[model samples]
Target: MNFLVYAGVKLFTLLLLMLAGGLFLKALDRLIFPEVDFAHELREDNEAVAKVVAAAILAWAIALALVLG
Candidate 1:
């Protein structure tokens, strides 16, 4: 039960981090490339960004599991 709770917490944290990171990246893109039409770029490249964010979250989750399990 404790391990389950720990895993759940880690998963939740990982998701939040991924979401925040994705938003931050989008904001940075807007700031750096104000004329680039990020919404259109996002529509085209969302999958790539999602994959990168997922990879990052997964890495963090795995590390947390190893350390806390």
Candidate 2:
């Protein structure tokens, strides 16, 4: 019962964190590229933009891992 409760809480927390991260990223996107349409780029399948975004995300992940480690 304790394990079940713990697992449920952990799942909820992770989902919440992911949503918050996405919102934060959106804000960052707007601030960094106010003139850019990230959604449009994604829709048009822009690989260069995608690659840059992916690299930014990976860098963030690495920094997060390092801090959390």
Candidate 3:
């Protein structure tokens, strides 16, 4: 139905927004966490940076969600 299609489109848009936000985070991660190398920490499986990145993404998602609403 139309509602189902609209929901699907919204979900897809959310997915894309998350992806873009993550990339934005990565791009700014260095300036934000200059003490740590984002890509290196990621490859070495560093939990600290992981959490920081997750938080940034969540913050971004929340802001985006608010705007979308």
Candidate 4:
């Protein structure tokens, strides 16, 4: 039905937006911390890096929710 098609497209768009948001976060991290390796830090049990990433993700989710609404 047309509703099913619309729902599928909306879901696909949401998935793409989530992927883009993650890439944006990664790019922002690299831009802000050119020398620091967040992946390595996270592997080394760096709480600070985890917290920062979590905060960024939360912020991104909030922004997405607002936009979607």
TM-score of every model? 0.55, 0.73, 0.65, 0.81
User: Over all chains combined, what TM-score does candidate 3 have?
Assistant: 0.65
Report residue 8 deviation for candidate 3 (angstroms): 0.7
Q: Rate the local accuracy (lDDT) of all candidates.
A: 0.71, 0.80, 0.82, 0.87
lDDT of each residue in 1-69, candidate 3, tens digit only = 999999898888888888987777777876777787877987899999789767866888789889667
* Order of candidate numbers by lDDT, starting with the best: 4, 3, 2, 1
Candidate 3, superposed: residue stretches over 4 Å from native = 31-34, 38-54
For 1-69, candidate 4 gives per-residue lDDT tens digits of: 999999898778888999998898789878989899999999999999999878988998898778776
For 1-69, candidate 1 gives per-residue lDDT tens digits of: 999998798888867866876687678768977886645755787777567556755876686567555
- Report the lDDT tens digits of candidate 2 across residue range 1-69: 999998787677666766777799899989989999888997899999889878977876675556444
lDDT (0-100) at residue 16 of candidate 1? 80
TM-score, candidate number 1 = 0.55
Error of 1 at 17 (Å): 0.2
Candidate order (TM-score)? 4, 2, 3, 1
Off by over 4 Å in 2: 56-69
